[model samples]
Structure formats: C-alpha cells, structure tokens
Target: MKINKEEKTPWICDKCNKELQLSEIKVVYLGGSFEVELMQCPECKMVLIDETLALGKMIEVEKGLEDK
Candidate 1:
C-alpha cells in the first residue's frame, strides 16, 4: 500500500534522535491504525503506536531484520 506522504510523519530514534527513513524502516500494526517502526537501535523497541490502544498483531516474514 502506498503510504500517504501527507501522513508520513518524520520519526526520530529515541535512542539517538536520528531521523528515520521509509526505506530503512518498517510498520508493525498495533491496532487502531497505529504502527511501529522496527528499527535497529535498542530504543527502537519502544512502542510506536498509541498507548491507549492495545497492541493488535505483529507479522514478520522472511526473518530478515528491518534494517540491513
């Protein structure tokens, strides 16, 4: 699905405060149209979605790391 560029908000890694890129990241659905960007830094493990919403489902195919 084409991500809405207008809705593509800039994400900064909490660990390093570095800006994220779509090509070097991923979106794990956590319900209510929220998502998680599974990055490499340890801080990336933090929930990327709304805290009020319960985490829905996470699917990882091919067993490849989000960032090469």
Candidate 2:
C-alpha cells in the first residue's frame, strides 16, 4: 500500500519559538501517532529533542508503573 505523505506541520522552538520551514527540519516517524515521530527544528534543534525526550520519559514511567 502506498502511504500518502503528510503535509509538513509548522515547527517552532519550544524555548525560543523560532519558526522553521520544511527544508530546515527533519522528521522521523515512529510508525504511529504524530507525537511518536521525532521532529527536529533546524533553527533551534531544541523543541524536537526536548519534547521527544520528555515523551520518552513519560512512556518509561508509565511502563514501570504498569509492570507492578
């Protein structure tokens, strides 16, 4: 099956709010939800990593709790 490419979403630095265009950004899909993907803002390279890590931690915590 052919996957339709998603239109690029506007990306901004979470700390500085710097805007980035598609050419200046990198996206990695984790095979699911939008948040599961890594979005790197070239202008700052801040929001993407920061948000991804935060989400990763949240997932970890939830998994740990569930394993109990």
Candidate 3:
C-alpha cells in the first residue's frame, strides 16, 4: 500500500527539470518530523510524498496525536 518505489525510479522533477534522485528526506507534521525515503529533486530539494505514505503513516500519526 505504498507508492511505486522501484517502478518510479529516476523521476523527472517538475520544478527543476532535472532527474529526481532517490534520497532520504524529513517529513514534518504537528511539530514532529520523521525520515522518509522518496524521489526528490536534488537541486531544488522538492520531495514527492506518496499517497500511501500520507494516508497510511501520516494519518495514523495524526490520529495518535489527537488521542494523546
């Protein structure tokens, strides 16, 4: 239930017009941050957060925060 990690390698960045590289980036929500693997624009540092990661892990974290 995650984005195409292997299928979408060497992505083309929309902003920089450069090839996106697989890298680790930090995602922040509700004053918390966590590392996530993603294809990102190396030049402009734009991260492509997948729908599965957002709907799955991100939502779960938000819900956990609410319950705390």
Candidate 4:
C-alpha cells in the first residue's frame, strides 16, 4: 500500500494540544475488522482519518460489503 505524503504531513490533537503519533489501529465496521495506519493522539489515543481514505477506499469497500 502507498500513502500520499502531502496529505499526511503532520498533525496535532485538539483536545490534548499535543503532536499526534503514527500507529496501526483496528477499525471494526459491519462486523468486520481492518488494520489501518492512522495518526493518533498519544495522550488520548484518538484516531484520525483523512479525507482520502474516508472518501476513497473506505466508502468503496463499504458499498461492496454485505451483512453476511
């Protein structure tokens, strides 16, 4: 998998007011779990999702899945 560097430069947490850390997270949707790399707040562990994933692959895969 490839990541766009320009889209994921750096980020800070609004609640903690601290720099975010790059980590792999488990995201579950519709009874399915996926491991994705995201920027998260070290203090709060709040995961961040970018527009590329939200509007791109995330939505694409969502439409292709069934409840079974």
Candidate with the greatest lDDT versus the true structure: 3
True-structure lDDT of candidate 3: 0.84
Please give the TM-score that candidate 3 achieves against the real structure. 0.78
Best-fitting candidate, scored by TM-score: 3
* Cα distance off (Å), candidate 4, residue 46: 0.5
Model 2, 1-68: lDDT tens digits are 87668865666767667775333333333322223345555656653455655677556656666777
Candidate 1 on 1-68: residue-level lDDT in tens? 88876885667777678665433344544232324444343445443443332332333322233433
List per-prediction Cα lDDT, in the order shown.
0.44, 0.53, 0.84, 0.82
Instruction: Residues 1-68, candidate 4: write the lDDT tens digits.
Output: 98876785569899999899989998776555678898999999998998986787677567768533
Query: In model 3, which regions exceed 4 Å deviation?
Result: 1-9
lDDT: which is higher, 3 or 4?
A: 3
For candidate 1, give the lDDT of residue 43.
43
Question: What's the candidate order when arranged by decreasing lDDT?
Answer: 3, 4, 2, 1
Residue 16 alpha-carbon offset, candidate 1, angstroms:
0.7
lDDT of 2 at 33: 28
Write the number of the candidate with greater lDDT, choosing between 2 and 4: 4
Indicate the residue-level lDDT of 13 in model 4. Answer: 96
